[model samples]
Target: MGRFLLAIGAPPDRASDMWKRFEESGAMRLAVELEGVQLWSSVDLPLSIEPGGSRMILGQVRSRSLGDDDHPSGILPQHEQWPSWPKLIEAFWGPWLGIEYKHRSLRLELVRSADIEMPCYYALAAGGIYAASDADLLVAAGACTGEIDRAALASALVYPAHRPSSTVLAGITELEPGRRLEWTPGRLRGHALWNPWDFALPPAQIHDLQIAAETVRDAVLIAVRGCSAGQRVILGMSGGLDSSIVAAALRATGAQWSGVTTVSAEPAGDERYYARCVAEHLQVQLAEVPDNIERIDLRQCHAAHLPRPNSRSFSQSADKSMLEIAAASGAKAYLHGGGGDNVFAMLDSVRPVLDRALDTSGWAASQTVCDIARMTGRSVVDVALRAGRLALRHGRDAPRIGNSAFLSQSVLETAEFPHHPWLDTPPGARPGKVLHVNWLIGIQNFLEGHAGQGDLPYRAPLMAQPVIEACLRVPTWMWCTGGRNRAVARLAFEAMLPAQIMTRSAKGTPTSFLYDILEAKRDEAREMLLEGNLASLGCLDRDKVEAALGAVQRLMSGDVLALMRLIDTESWIRARIARQRD
Candidate 1:
């Protein structure tokens, strides 16, 4: 919810010059430069910053926080916590450092937790290394070459949305989620901590659903206990299982809560009935904001609040509408049902996992392989063998077939590469044996993607670490549909939820307004796609670009997805260009 920028290599005397670039940008909150590695935090809060040799560090200490006196960790011990930050820096930097700190005993270079919880960016350049919280701030520091990366462009154009940290700009790599990088002279060191092996199952244990659900409910309640008393907590009620579960958890916590929904007013997309059911179940008040763009003047607001690349799910008009509701709601934090799909369903990335899960005969495995082969435009049996090889390479015991093409890729990438400290598995464990591990991967991916973005403190009780750890330990019959087929979440929700809410389907599906944006503004959308400053950004495949846009035009009028894909691509490209110009 806050942005901070730190730049090393400036002379102690001219530190003010470096601070000016980030502080004056309006995007940052408080920008400070200090001598001997400054540690700055509210005196009452346990959080702080300090110096370790040449690098700076930041972190928080567990103590009673000032915001909520009832909270056990009341306030951070600033000076003491400062030393702990350097210990974190060392984790990212590895060895080769003489340590220094603002606080002597705490040792910022060598003490404390691994959760740095700070949004930071860094780049290695000829002069030295530069670090900041925002990508734009990095550009302003003169460390960036101002050239867009073509690979990122290809990813955005071909994939659904631009993945986090992987922007459409060239030579500019984001520190991947859960990872950090350090620079010293001619070297750069990096490390990621979100390992799935951390949550690996014991040799003879299986999780129980009833007990696991209660444990999940408890963790969510514990999180709610930290909320400031007398504050109204907001839930982004989508009438879906994830959000409903979160709302129920808040109710169970006995906290003051409210529900908010952004209804597109396009047919049945309005979540009033399900949201009301949730509210009534919790006995809480509900507020509904129709997705009406004309009611709020987007043009004026965009200029006033967002003069750069502002990407919204729908048109700028819908963006303005949502902002208005948030402002009016007086809610500081919102709970979301965001990660249910990744954890519950096989999702779009099932094929790879399926290829690894099946125990079919050589002939059947060959057929499965052929299916994958044909999908990728290769020979059937040959592709089947290739699929088996890929499964073996990824350490899957059996391969599942007929899963979603996109999600299958996710499983392949995630299974192949370890992202968390806990994701480490035995060398020969088959893919089918690691369903719980895959669930953890999906959870990590969700947190890194959604919770890390925008202005909301989007909480996911269902994806809570303990929830997923427990889910993985339970039977696969409760989570996957086709051994990887479909509707795993739907079945589980039905068992736990009220019948009306349980039977309801559809979540976050953009309604008719999305198609309306295209139908009413096709010319405008085309102009932005073809003639806007974004088109000339030079990193995207011009042919793929044209093909996607042309496809958008020929698609059915109600295909909100196609329209969104087109607009998101355009917006991403436009934002990159705008950032470059800035």
Candidate 2:
């Protein structure tokens, strides 16, 4: 990936002057200001830049493209100068420049995709406007002083699905997903660039199974067309519907493919037999990794990737390692069945409301909020009541993404904030709508941000804008008309995928390796927790942390959710310390 930085508000004539400013501060090169936009480019890793005299620091990083046969170097070329500001802006945004500009005051011209591939962070202080692509670099520019925000920490501890806008530290606000913040002079405005409510399922859009199949096929083709022609694409096939369909999609595109199945020696995690069947059916090479949880190095892992105390012990280190393995094995791009669950409308189970007096008008066909609360030991009644209230408020006949259990507690708490002062609804009214909102948020904020930092390009064919738009137009009954899950997308994909893949039901959850991995590293896990590497940060509950780790040491099987939370907490704590040092 390449890094580009721009500092506006500085005098255009000070080319050499800006150069020295950057050089003295170890910034890669001199800064250039043109047409009210100053810019700099760097190919170095661990990118760092000094504060400029201007209030704007716009950084654009181009990650390795999935397909770039035209560019022999496997990198997207950066034109030294654009013909006009609009062209340069379009280059950064791709297809997003057409969206309405609500937060225009930030005076910053932002044009990233709905999925945030290249993330930008800004902090207004006495020092002027400060922005950076990396959180560490933003801190280095004196934007945030390595402090954690307590509310953000609480949200993280409570929900593992998404990250909130405000971090653990007070003053440092994160740009939420699907949100664009523009700050200029005395005003700052952040607007939701996308809302699932804006997109509706069209009535009787696709009854013809053939039409659905072709649509799915077309979506898959469009998703992979940008990949490097011969790059081996990696699929996380689990013999489940999502990955299986994806595998079939790759085969249809004539793309060379390989599959990785994380198998447990026991029956529980081993989807290998089914996975093998699907792989063979699709004629793709597959590899199996026996992830023995009993012998994993949990403590060492904690020491390396996680330093905070963890109540969850075992984890499959294989998932992390497999990416590098796949890359080394000649795969330049990886595609997974991520976003399949949301697309498929795979409501886990429906709960019958006890309140016979209440009309179903206030609720979606699926009781998502209630189901979620039940699964997580939360108050189901309260969640359901909120959903009912939301349906009544929006006056929209359709079930929105914001009305689900996962959205209110997991997705929104983790990824978004309590903004959007424009509307009024029950606390839980927009359960489905919130999730749809986060779909945009995840694309515009999280996915791209993470990928950019890691120097890898990530694409989700399932979450492609066109695919989402089509699925939204589909009727709920048509969604698996034959009683199949993910009916809409599955039906859409029928022509592109094998019948075996299109009809699969069982799915794999990554948490299956949770307990096994923790047990293997029990001792190391205890040491890391007791050592208090992360306790120095006042934002955590040390007593609770110790107890959690101790409980995890006693587990034999797996608790995937707890395990993920442990890793997330530890990583966050460590990142806080590292950022503080910066």
Candidate 3:
């Protein structure tokens, strides 16, 4: 991913002077300078400028329309195509950031697409707007006040995956994905380019699992082909259906690629059986890296340089091993089936049954209830009763943005947890659809990180826009059809997959490895949490934290997960402070 730093509306003098600052310490080189805009990019990707500069695109990008070539982040769509800004911006993908200069009403409006596939952040500081693909880049450039947003950090401990658009730094705000940010002289506003709810509603719903299968099948292929972009692809194979589909797509594109599966010491985390199946079936090279529990250092913060803490102790080995393989093989990015479960609506609640009953006649929906039963391993009577209650409520209620009372009452009382932008639903929205949209929210963190050039950045083609939109358009119940979760996805690629993968139901996870991290590093975790930076900032409850870690115990009551988040966040705070000192 090409790194970029953009300053919009800065004073002429500051814009000119910032060059020395970047040259001295920043990660990007100066790329563009307009009347009020100055852009810096890591790579000198050619600037796509409109004649005489009425419109322009700076930095590298890959579009759905042109996946084979990655450049020329599109010119603004004609009036006939997109009537809004976010819609105009949403077509591009990647943490590789870009800024489009579009002229409107004699005013220059530059909108950065920060949703779904791309990561963008903006802060109005020193009487101007500063934006960057990496948040720490902006901080390093002195574009932000550098004051930590403590409440935001506290909220992250409670809800890491769906943290609000605001960043931990007080002055910077992350641009929400699938939305547009509008900046005028002294004010800012937001507009959504698109949303999952649009397809979940009645008008866009598709009942045919067959059509849904075909749609996702094609979209994933296009996404993977485009993402491969002639670079040697490295597949993080888990031997699960999701990663298998990624392998199938790579084979279809005839791209140069290989696979790696992380094998855990414990049997539960071992999926080499299935990983072998995929590599042999497709006739591609495969590697197995040990998920070495001993390698996890609770103290090492590899992502400490990032704007937020992304390092989970258990993922450290897998991440490091992948990087080694990438360096050895000359791969720039790692592809996985990251969002397949969420996109395919593999949820635990009876929400799908509720949605099916509401969308189909009773006789037509009866079979779906049976399917839900088998898919979730619950009885038909229980599933129907839960779905019936959900229908009576017309699907308005929602679970809390996050759940964990790990924080002190003082923190919880004043925290003001943020709601997801999409949660503010329109009237008559289905409860199941709301939950479906939320499931998408849950997997977002998996797709993001500080993707440095040296790092083998993670890519999720299954979570691509067209692929997600296709899955969203299908009726939620359809995923649970045939007594299996993600049934549509299974059917979509059944012809391409080995029979074993097509029928495998037990997906692998690293929960056991995570527990191992906590157990092995119990003292380290206790010391970090009991007297760490977060407690000093009033983000953690010392008593509760001490009690949780004070005992050497099993992973119970989600306490271990909560404690790990605190440890991760604390490490990050220390790293951020240390960076400031440097």
Question: What is residue 212's positional error in candidate 2, in angstroms?
Answer: 4.8
> Using TM-score as the measure, which candidate wins?
3
Candidate 2's displacement at residue 518, Å, is 1.9
TM-score preference between candidates 1 and 3, better one: 3
**Which lDDT tens digits does candidate 2 get at residues 342-395?**
555554322212111122333533343444454434586765665467545743
Candidate 1 minimal-lDDT segment of 10 residues: 298-307
Tens digits of per-residue lDDT for model 1, 93-201 = 1111112333232222212122222334456554455554446555655556545554443444333322344444444554543454544556566665433343333
Q: Please, what is the whole-model Cα lDDT of each candidate in the order they appear?
A: 0.44, 0.47, 0.72
Query: What TM-score, computed on C-alpha atoms, does each candidate reach?
Result: 0.67, 0.67, 0.91
Find the candidate with the highest lDDT and give its number: 3
Which residues of candidate 3, in runs, are more than 4 Å off? 44-47, 58-108, 450-454, 550-553
Q: Per-residue lDDT for 88-202 in model 3, tens only?
A: 4455544333345443421334454433555677777776778777667677657775666777776666667675677777777877666656665677787666777777787
Cα RMSD for candidates in order: 8.6, 8.5, 3.3
User: lDDT of model 2 at residue 310?
Assistant: 26
